[model samples]
Target: MAYLRLFDWYQTNKRDLPFRKTDNPYHIWVSEIMLQQTQVDTMLPFYDRFLTIYPTIQDLARADIDEILKVVQGIGYYRRFRMLHKGAQYVIDHHDGKLPEDYFKILKIPGIGAYTAGAIMSIAFHKPYPATDGNVIRVLSRVKMLEDDFRLDKNKKKLNEMNKELIENSNNPYLYTQSMMELGATVCKVSNPLCDTCPLQEVCLANINNVQQNYPKMSPLKTKKEIQYFTFILEYKEGFLMRKRTEDLLHGFYEFVQIESDSLNGALTQAQDLGLEIQILDELQPIKHVFTHMIWQINLYRGTISNITSPYEIVHDFSQVPIATVVKKQIKQI
Candidate 1:
């Protein structure tokens, strides 16, 4: 692959991330899982805190799910943490509390997919495995001047195979993997790539053709569905009434009383049906929250509730509870 120059560039220019400083596979695995959706800067503090709390995978395995949820409250995508928790337990029971060294064995753990497994294998074990994250894909797609749409499964498989061969034959697997990722994130960006600063400037076909932006062509995305709802944070005796979510993606999280409605009166009617007796105080501003598949046009409100017929918890402090990020956004300032 002739990536020795790329390796040198990475050593000289890579960001000084905490995970990169450690050879611990568990630490690198945690970083990979967190970095799956979050940017490095936003995830740095949480990473440090999480490691402080759970110094070892064994510590995570013994921790409660509620505490784990609280630790990563604002991070979003809580399912990953749940899976990581389960993976820790799995490693304890099957791998003697040690992160598996083999790629396939690591993949057997929950929440670890191909990219994560590859990252752990190469970055931690220094094995020759292709870690084709989004950044890596973009960088390689441009370097090879690939015309195939990377969105398609077959095209992605080809890219993996190509990079797999490159890493297997590279001067150093760990450096090559991180170097490709660093180059994509810093040099060969999705927009306005820095060709002059790129180590692979001479070999990049996208650069040779002067159409770097046109190389990694992606398919159009499906439109996210949008919905409107009215949500209320009803104050009770010295506290606010909220409910713990027991279903779907937000399971094991807390949320305010929300009704899928367009009007305040209609929302109140829905609330009445659910055995909620409330006195309307005032209506605050509305908020809109977007998810991967749907958009929530939430009409936010605050009021006092005299009594509750259904099961609901009275929370004195919202911060003390592991509320969903959407609910946290609408927390009533006391």
Candidate 2:
């Protein structure tokens, strides 16, 4: 009955997202991957541009990683793109370029997990599969009024099983899954839920008791690790020297000459190691960047490099390179 009500509400209330316009599995897969830990509004432009570049799975499988990352650069979370690329290649090689409809087979793909695999199966293939995301988890927890910490593995596993059963029993699995997600995102939000507008308000235990926030119990956030870096825009004749990061955190992304130094003297010492006598033309204001697990305090400096090197790549055109967002912000300060 709740499913029916949610579906009815979704018929007119669903957001007209571009990904919802088609039943193509490839498109849906791309959208699902992009949607992970990313806001819909922020990813829309990037999704459109990404599809324009690699409209087909085959096209994506063949595109260079650099080219793919260039398009996905500003969107952040480069690892997702890398995984998408690997998944596309896997699909092409094994599944004949078509996304497998079988849930197990789809799960075997490099980037896809339980949620993504379920979404593609139900939405694109019209199969009975449940895709439980964070929003869906919240909705289910409140509907059942489960007091268990939803962040715990046992509770999450239980919710996934519950969702699977719900999907299996539903007459319209496709609409059921989508509508549930829509309801959670728009109506049954985590904080200050729109209980009056929610279709499940009457049936939801959390809503009836006015304890929506207390249902989906969350774990405390961990302390953000602090790190300090000295970034330099080593400008040569007409370009800045850039290097590809092979280290952990933002691995494989490009950035200006940088070193992990908290002080100017220490940064200068590291700069000398690179065989460059840098005259500090400008010392920009310090910039702070917060990642999921860490906080970066960056000191930015800009100066023309006295020595040109073969180890560094010269980038004159910013548009042509796929630079990390943190590095771009530092460059903008110069």
Candidate 3:
């Protein structure tokens, strides 16, 4: 409802994205999966590369897991790719190679959540549905001047319902979804919103009340757990030693042998107890990598190993392996 200005502005100002040019549900679904927890600019190349390789739901379903991971290695958050791969396969196996048009049916796919399902239905299927992402929440919360903490489930549901009504009234679901996304991303930005130029400035209560920054009230975030690890890259005659991580955070990826110790001496004692003797050649520069809830303060040190007993493999080349970005950073040091 009353989205003409927003739609007109989007037509003139929206960035030319590959996904925007197509109404194909498969393509849009791929884009939605990639865009989760990733910026458009960053996900663009990987999107292109992934499409070049997979090209269709069938291709994506049949492709090997390692190949899938290799294509999207540097994108961080490895689990997104894993789930996307499974979702595509689910489409092939269950939906007969077509992305479902029905909202509830599409959610059966492995990684398609409420927001993704809504996006697909509205944008690709041209059905009136609300895609209530963070941007939309911010925009709507500011417009209605709701001070309820959106972090809470009840407040979020309220915003989602409001957006649902707005989209239903628009009658042009595609433009309603895309235009809202564009407005939130480009104009009603988190900081320094361009209120004077915004199409919805008249409707935005926060802008009218001169409280643009305060409307979408949120609870404080949990503190990130910081951990110090003495990272090791011990080289034998074979190559560098790398451990296959089975931990949930970075599972099915390669990482250097790392021990949770603040000091090298402590790590060395631990290493000795494992029946491995490392001749420390030099201490390379340290690196820090931050995940969603945890931060790894990696103290990197590269050296040659004299004796070994713990199970690990020597990697001559790591190009094929699904190496995490943090491990890749340490790789750059050596």
Q: List the residue pairs that clash in candidate 1.
A: none
Judging by lDDT against the true structure, name the best candidate.
2
Residue-level lDDT tens digits of model 2 in 1-334: 4777888899989999999998889999999999998888999999999999999999999999988888998788889889999999999999999998899999999989989999999999989988999988989889998877876888888899999999998988899889998988898887889999988989999889988879688888889999999878878878888887887678777888777986889988987887868888888888899999999898888888777665678888888877788988877776
Give Cα-based local distance difference scores for all models.
Answer: 0.87, 0.88, 0.87
Which runs of model 2 end up more than 4 angstroms from their true locations? none
TM-score of 2: 0.97
Off by over 4 Å in 3: 307-310
Instruction: State the displacement of the C-alpha of residue 160, model 1, in Å, after optimal TM-score superposition.
Output: 0.9
Expressed as tens digits, the lDDT of each residue in 80-100 for candidate 1 is 999999999999999999997
Residue 25 lDDT in candidate 3: 86
Number of backbone-clashing residue pairs for each candidate, in the order shown: 0, 0, 0
* TM-score (C-alpha) between model 1 and the true structure: 0.97
Query: Judged by lDDT against the true structure, how good is candidate 3?
Result: 0.87
